[model samples]
Target chain A: MAEHSVTAAALTARHQTAGSAASVRRLPGFGWSVGLIVPIMVLLLWQLAAGGAWIEADLLPSPATIAQTFWAMVQDGSLANDILVTVYRLALGFVLGTAAGTVAGLLTGALPLARRLLDPTLQALRSVPSLAWVPLFILWFGIYDTSKVILIAVGVFFPVYLNLMAAIAGVDRKLIEVGRVHDYGKLRLMLRIQLPAAMPLYLTGIRGGLGLGWMFIASAEMMGANNGLGFILTNGEEIGRPDQIIVAILAFAVLGKSTDWLLARTAERLTDWQDKLHPETGA
Target chain B: MTRRLDISDLTKAFGAAPPVLGPLSLTLDGEGITAIIGRSGSGKSTFLRCLSGLETPTRGTAMLGGKPIRPAEVGFVFQEPRLMPWLSVRRNIAFGLSHLPKPERARAVEAAMALVGLSAAADYLPKQLSGGMAQRVALARALAPRPDLLLLDEPLSALDPLTRERMQDHILHVAQHIRVTILLITHDMDEALALANRVIVLRGPPGRIVLDVTIPEHDPAYAFPRDRTSAAFQAMRRRLIDALEPAPVALAR
Candidate 1:
């Protein structure tokens, strides 16, 4: 704990020296090549395995076959449509879940009455698996976009709510005292000090929620949705098309990674104050 | 207008047991500096917090300018520089001045920053500042609203010796320039002697003022380093130390 605070202090000091003009550091081309090496090697191993008939082609499609199937799907507009539908569902559910969770978390974290009345129920509810909600949701909302969206929202809510509440509850009491000394009212205290102090944690919650959001999309789509990446996976399975199945799996991987990357970049910008203080100095 | 503080029969208790501060009474001038000296757990902090309205007194009245002292009328600096890490230096300074109009608030923040020699660091966040610099920002934040009473709870104790000395001088400068009623809490006898016109020592389970010594205003030896080596300073320091020392075992029994 002492060492952590010292490092934090050092980082903040370094950030102060850098001032307001944030210098953007670009990765070298060599870095990109270094990053790609492992992926390329894995692809090569997989291709060699397929060519040598070490694995059945039907069970595990070749990278080339998956790429060809992906291209064909893209040409026919189905890949784009599937990606769009899934992304739309993911975005909408994530926003709703995050919004509701933030409100609930803030309320419970700040108010004893709210915590007493709501926290136990929410905690019990969250323990139930995300997939467990699907049957109940389908019965209530029917096997349409509503059920899928609600399922994803339910998945996203727990992580965001739990993390956000913990973050708010953990805000330094000393900092809050500073606000109180300044005569900040309840609203100002929460908005200006507490919320900003809780932001790094809130962002963590959002990132976790986003990951869960994507996970639930697959579950949601696999059950009933007919035009998403999950739907494509289900369709490929029914038709025994390993190549198409591999393409859908690859699409999910790329989409998840890309969105996570985007969230990470946003988090980096939001937490520049913290990052600048304790920058990663060595390999 | 300058505000005179009259704290009468002020006492604070945590639970039903011994009070942190016993019933104590003192009157302070509306200007210049006064330092409180005590050992650890001396209730000096409790006294300061009560004055700042951060903690409610168990019993007693603390009045400023013939009215009850409100939190708004006082600015407090804690032992640690409790600056909001997310806020820039300018924003932290401006934190209390939000009650003012936007332009006035901005001007107040700018003036406070300039007063503390932090104009160059206005846009930098707290994480970017050195220990001394962050403490300076905390001081600036306290001063921005121009409160009549400034309560400092060992604000310079955390800094390195050299930085602490420099901060002491800076605080002395601010005290003289602003003419605000200053109540500083410290364990350092030399610090109390150097910076304050009056020093009060508190010691007890239920803490009360045990000694009140006035530094001669006209003595050249009472000023900073010149006073450090002076016989008068040494005599005063000795007196304060004797007063702060615990009672003998026979006397306690």
Candidate 2:
């Protein structure tokens, strides 16, 4: 009987580190292999096009020439500095935007008064097609890092704000009833029931917010100032160096894809208890 | 620690709609399980919800052990398991026990799991469990708090026939052994007869009790998973079915 009594405490702790074994499922490994084939084929075709005379060397530099340029930039440490600056801006902007959006979304979704006061203004701002903020922001904050970072933040805020609010509002009434039965106070109900229930959709919103971060950063970097991947693109164009242009484009591609892959993996771990009998990574 | 429930003139209305249940009153002794049998939309869930404090009554009050009923003392299980998908079975059962000290809460959770035979599945998520297994976890979750009154809202209605019957037996065993006043809402007459010592038959769009029957534990007909072929069980089943039918209209001569 004593042993039986202790079992409950032990059972409750078991899943804390077990990573939700029951929800584990076989991912479509074959489909992933098939998906990889298409990208590899595309890369090979581009290489062939450059190797043959199908594309002019000066107009669309050979893949080897682009690779050489990429190595030269790497050796000089310019490539590393560019990546560092751009990624730093994106990180700082994304964190600020995400934090602000979460607070706003929580208030709006949970309280009618907050929605009435804030939602209309936010929604109106969201409709302003974002890029239109560029010139005005530059005038106000100047062409330093502040305007650029703020631009990326403006782009990120909407998706997180919208998704989190909707997700919280859409929580199941039945689950709320469960909280009522437990006689939970407002804070406990929101923390334990509303927040966890809203998380899967909220994570999806973060992915959207991050995508917009990458989008806004390109235009923000293009506007002014020095060392960044976007600057390299403009600089190569000014100098008529197609290989350098290709190097910048390739850098952006790798950075964007790898960051997204990292996010998808984290989300998969966090939401393992989700109903993913079918793999909808939605990443 | 179970207590008798005394209900008086309890009525619920939504806006301009007529009262959904009761201007009626009854008392239930906390001797064993009492099942409420009614047709769909007969305010079966509404009544359970009212007692669970999920819905407020338009009039009157319910008292447990001669005092005004506190919502905290009531436990409710819905038609579906309604478990938090992200929580393990063990955590879900421990949900209502946050008010208890850690050691006591653990003991209570273990006891509830043992009662429902779900101790082995404590680490599983709701999505991983079969329908019957999920329902058992729900039963444990409700029972863990040791409520003075437990209300079940057609908890087995979603299961297949085989699983439903199996759960019926499980409910019978749990009710017989646990000291709690359970008010069960079920459409199935067999389920009502199998589990309850007192079966309240209700009728209405504006719900009211039509017949309230009690079977003594010593009565030869009082059987767990009531014998379908038995004459006594069949007769009682027909009475409940007939009570649910609409009243006959007066003929114009």
Q: For residue A145, what is the lDDT in candidate 2? A: 92
What is the clash count for each candidate, in the order shown? Answer: 5, 0
lDDT by residue for model 2 (A79-194), tens: 99999999999998999889888998899989989999999999999998767999999999999899999999988899999999998888999898899898988899899899
The sequence of per-residue lDDT tens digits that candidate 1 reaches over residues B1-253 is: 4777999999999988889897989999768789999998889999998988789999999999989988888999999999888779999899998889999999999888777777777888886678888898999999999989999999999999988987897798788788689999999998998899999999976889999987878777776544587798889999999899956878878
lDDT of candidates 1 onward, in order: 0.87, 0.84
Candidate with the greatest lDDT versus the true structure: 1
Q: Give the 10-residue window scoring lowest on summed lDDT in candidate 2 chain A.
A: A1-10
List DockQ, one per candidate, in order.
0.49, 0.35
lDDT of 2 by residue, B1-253 (tens): 5677899998888888888888868899865788998888778788888888888889988889999878778888899999998899999999999889999999999899989877777777886677887898898899898888888999999999988887887787778887888899998888888788889988887889998988767877765556777888888888877787755655532
Error of 1 at A211 (Å): 0.2
User: What's the C-alpha lDDT at position B112 in model 1?
Assistant: 85
